[model samples]
Target: MTILENIRGPRDLKVLDEAELDELAEDIREFLIHAVAGTGGHLGPNLGVVELSIALHRVFDSPADRILWDTGHQSYVHKLLTGRQDFSKLRGKGGLSGYPSREESAHDVIENSHASTVLGWADGLAKAHQVLGRDDHVVAVIGDGALTGGMAWEALNNIAAAEDRPLTIVVNDNERSYAPTIGGLAGHLAALRTTDGYERLLAWGKDVLQHTPVIGQPLYGSLHGAKKGFKDTFAPQGMFEDLGLKYVGPVDGHDIAAVESALRRAKRFHGPVLVHCITEKGRGYRHAEQDEADRFHTVGRMAPRTCEPSEPSIGPSWTSVFGDEIAAIGAERPDVVAITAAMLHTVGLTKFAARFPDRVWDVGIAEQHAAVSAAGLATGGLHPVVAVYATFLNRAFDQLLMDVALHRCGVTFVLDRAGVTGVDGPSHNGMWDMSLLQVVPGLRIAAPRDADQLRAQLREAVEVTDAPTVLRFPKEAVGRPQPALDRVGGMDVLHRSDDAGVLLISVGALAPVCLQAAELLEGRGLGCTVVDPRWVKPVDEQLAPLAAAHRVVAVVEDNSRTGGVGSAVGQALRDAGVDVPLRTFGIPEQFLAHGKRGEVLADIGLTPVEIAGRISAALVRVRTKSREEYGR
Candidate 1:
């Protein structure tokens, strides 16, 4: 039998010969090309990490010796070896997650799909291992591009501090992150890729010259004398040793035997060491190699809900709505421009880039720079709409609060994927936007329930001349439109009832659930009113008087139950001396797993049926208390 078919887990991989291992790597690559084409995932990154993953499993005993993936896209190869061979249902509703999921396997250490946080995890795991006297190694496999992030540096500083911190940080030098890696460290890493064993053999040859006869010694010594200057001119890195890391390689990452030797050497080391393995992002696949962008970094929705070709380009996502709306705004206003943190295509701002090539700024994977620069753009009398994913916005929180919100800059923050984004799981979810952004004083946050509202609210946010405004939306479609009833205190009342006992307050794209929940409550004999608090922050003053009028208020939102808009409304009512019992409904604080958005929402009791049931039960208790007090 073949080695691959005989392999059930990492244990089976340990027995393979070098020839079999190389052959197995080819099979995995061919398997990925077909599997990823069918399912459409981060194909290129996984393709690059095939040999690296095999060497990792073959070298380290995993689950005990923790392996953490920085961006997690590269973990697909790691998954395949650890018994996740079924790529047919990958990223499907009930299928395997796009990133490393802790629930999916014991091999996955940290469930991070986001970039640049793996070092911090590595530091923590290594420290934990040291404290508990656990003899296991904590290995963090991070790409070169992940090095650009400030957090990675911060983690590096800490990891460097621990003198004998038994950490093996494998620098997967693909020479790129999303776009090509930037800064001085990228240059340092480039040296590792280019300056192979060419310099080493030269030094060893010079040593042979000294041991030769008198005539030979004269010739050898002259060349050996000039070697320092020559090697200095040739060698690309002087800094890795300065950082106290034992620098090894510029080794061919694609070659399994070379990588296995390097990893085997890294495994025996005591202190922190960096094994630089040079790899091509789209190593084997020609289509991905030619993909001038990020080698199909994150694939857009390929097929329709029916698995047909009519899917309409990832189905006119909320990201597209922002891109088109903002571009239209840019056309209308002469001073308007756009800024994105290395995500022009993902944010759907490619058309803006095409139209106003000079106006659009594609700042490379740097969110902090994007925000602070937007503040500068606004300072120069231009209205800049910073379009970034809500999760990435977390990176620039200090910049947002200090530079933009504190100054009250006329910067429009268009946050796409503003709520529970499913398949990407815990790290990628925009669920915490409400809780965190609420702390930004003078920042107005609006959530559009549909595409139409997204357009209108975006324009309104842009037109507001004095303060910073944010428009948030989910990853999926902007479902059926709801006519705006009233725009009071920056809130849109989607549905209202005169004799309503419950108030359904929604923030952002989850207004559809409020409307549906209202319909269900209507059927359940409880009068309900749904209010889409379009702008979740600044505490809609009108909502207070509305809550004062109602006996019981249940606020339904897609954010966290803690410090969210729902909690704020509950606190607001209590502070205003409104004796109404408020039930704040939101996602409970936990790491949510992979599923369809609808299925995840239903699982968390955010569905219309659950909302209606909770509201109805609240109403029954309140009425029963009223009857007991009045002697009825």
Candidate 2:
């Protein structure tokens, strides 16, 4: 049997010899390449951390000693070591999640897939351990890219202040998060990687001074007193030392023995200690190493040998449409600029960056900084289009509200993966943007129904130079253009029935599904009028009058149903005194599991057949209530 086959848990790893551990690492990599190529997941990050993860499991006892992973995407190797190696339906419906899950195992602590949050969690856990008088240790494994976030520094400050706290911070320096890490911290880390240790400097002083004259003895005494200044001048290892935390070696992350030694040293230190380990992003795979864009950070189902996609491209994605349109906008408007939070290529800003190199800015993995900086740029007479994944925009909510909306800045937010990005699981699905942005005063949100609408609404969003405007789209391919038969104010009348009983309001990419549901309702002798409100935020003024003309009104969206466009339309009807029975259909207010987009939508009852059936039942109840009122 293979070394990996016999391993059931961390205890299995503890018993392995050096050769057996090396063989186990090879087996795990082979398993990952085959398993992930079939299912698709984070391949590069997990491949890079095989040795580090093995060393960590051997050195620390998890569940008792919390080993927290920042951004959780790098926990694949950890999962393998913890006896959860079943990768058959990984990231599929009722299968292993791409990230860590508390439901799956007791070893997984935090389930948050967002970056830069592990440090704060570690601080809190350590504090709790101290208060409860527990002897367990807290180890936080953070990536170099995650250090760019402001929250990491906040936690670092707190962790450093508590000199009595037992915390081991493992810095996994792969030198990239999505794209290459940016800003001052990245440069500082690069410098640290090339420098020698303080111990080497101390030894060099002893060797050189011992060969000198009688004055060497007197000079050594003065040098000992000024060792702090000497060390700062040569090594500059004072960055962590000044913060009151012990700093360990810049060890080779791939060398299991070296990493284990450093981890053991940090474990002995009672105070906060940091172990810096250097590793490559895609170490074992040649194809991943050749990928310069994102280092194959995330991959789709692919051929293991060639690294090519297993499936062909369906069509032009929503991002490509935005990419072409935004680049054209930059060519015409000299005042136009773009901002991304370390995701230039992911959010389709690459074309814009190529056209206007100086106009585009990558703010690292710091969404809050991206939002606040865009506000500053807007106030400085520039139109900045901040492009980010819809889910990540949640991190900058306070900045978007207080800095951009309150000041009435003309910052246009382009949200890619705006709704139900199913494959990456719940934390990645952009299902909350519409619901969360509802309370932001004067914020106009546009949910485009097709490629044409996405291009047009993007232009409209940039034209607004007073209040904040958001243009959001889903993660799938843009379908064939669905043209409107007519226009009603700001809404598009896709289909109209002679005996209009139900006014179906479609939001964003769900227009096609809404049209299908309308056809199903029409077959049942229920005439329906379908409209796509291109901009869904203010609940278009024309909708209240349209709802009054129909007996029942139904609104469908890909966002959460609680505070989505449907709820906004309901409120609009209430204010206008239109008492038509309304039904809101959308994703329920809960964390959706990982699956194919169609399957997850069907599971949540967002399919056309289910929607039509629900609407039909609601119509029956409404008619019965009307007859009862007449009888009364």
Candidate 3:
């Protein structure tokens, strides 16, 4: 059996010699490369942390000693060390989650796929340990890129507050979060990485000086006594030291022995300690290391040898469509600028950044700052499009509402991966944007049904210079363009029927599904009219009147049923005094499990057949009630 197979738990690692441990690390990497390539989860991030994860497990006892990961995509190595070696179905419906899950194992703590949240979790856990008078250790592993977030500093401020509390913070300085770590914190970490140790300098000086005459010994003694000042002058690690946390080495993260040594020292410290570990992001994989952008941060099913995708492309993804349209828009509108939260490529702002280099800003995992800064940019007489994943937009809702919407700033927010983003799990799903953004008074949302609508709606959104405008789209390929039969006010009439008994409202990518459902209803001897409400919010002026013409109205959205476009339609119909039976179809109010987008949708009854059956039942109930009332 291999060294890795012998290791079932952390206890198995303690008995291994240095050579055996090295073999184990190599075995782990080989397994990851093959397993993750087939399964299509985080490969580079996991490869980078093999040694670090091994060192952490060897130094600290996890489950008992809370080991937390900042963005839990890096926890694959951690998962393996804790007895979960199966990667056959990683990120699939019933398989291992992409991030930490509470249901997975006791070793997995928080499901922290969201970046820069581990420090806060660490602080609270440390406090709880202190309150309970427990000796259990708390170690939080956070990336240098995550440290660039404002919340990390906020948590650090609190972690520094308690001097007696023992907590270990390991800085996994891989230097990228989808892209290179940016802003002042990155520069500071770079300085720390390069700076020579003060202890080494002092020790060298002491050895040479003590060998010399009396004057040399006196001079060495004076410098050594004032070590705090001298150390600050020597190394740039004074940042964490000044924050009331004990500072440990800029150790080689790949060297298992070195990382273990630093972690041991941190564990022994009474107060909160920061252990700076320098490592490469894509450490064992040649292709991942050579990757200039994101270092293969996330990958799909691919051949590990050639690093090519296993399957062919479906077509232009929703992201690519947005990227092309936005780049074209940049040429027409010189006033338009783009902003991304350290994910220029992931959010499809790469072409825009490449074309208009100076006009774009990468805010570095700080979504809150991106929203507020967009407001600032708009006030400065420029229209800024803050593009980010819809799920991450939840972080900056306050900034979007108060800084942009309250002030009536003309900022366009482009939300990619807007709804039912499966595989990455519940936290990564962009299912909450429509529901959350509905309450923002001045914020108008556009859920485009196709590529043509996306382009048109994006241009329309940019044209508005009064308040915040949002253009949201899903993760996968853009479907075939659904041409409008006619236009009813602001809505696109996709399907029109005479003697229509049902009016179907389609939102965003679900237009195709709605059209299919309409066809099924028509076959059932129920005439159906399908309309795509391009702008979901503010409820198009003609929607209420249009709904009144049909016997029953059904609103289908890819977002939550509560407070979504359906809710807005229901409210609009009520206000217009249109007493019509309305049924809303959407994701249930619960955390959906990780799966394929189509699987998740079908599971939630968002398909055509399920929708048609439900609508038919609702229509029958309404007619039956009407007949009873007529008989009365």
Q: Rank the candidates by TM-score, best first.
A: 3, 2, 1
User: How many steric overlaps are in each model, in order?
Assistant: 1, 0, 0
lDDT of 2: 0.89
Worst 10 residues of 3 by lDDT: 176-185
lDDT of each: 0.78, 0.89, 0.89
**Candidate 1: where are CA atoms >4 Å away?**
37-40, 88-95, 124-136, 158-166, 175-232, 239-242, 265-271, 300-314, 486-490, 496-498
The digit string of per-residue lDDT tens for model 1 on 1-632 reads 54556667899898888888888988888777777667667878988898999988888899889989998989988988898888887876768888888788999877766778898998998998889999898888988887767778888778777757788888898864223333445445334322435345655776777677786679876775564344334333335644656555656788777677667666766667677788888777776677787875655444312223323544577877778877787777878889987678888888888889899997766789899999999989999989899888988999999999888899998888877887677787888888888888788888778888889888888987678898888888766678878766667778877776787787767777878888898887777777787777778778788877787888877788888888888777778778888888888998787666777888899888888888888889999999999995
Cα TM-score per model: 0.84, 0.92, 0.92
- Candidate 3 achieves a global lDDT of 0.89
Worst 10 residues of 1 by lDDT: 302-311
User: Model 2 clash pairs?
Assistant: none
lDDT of 2 at 341: 90
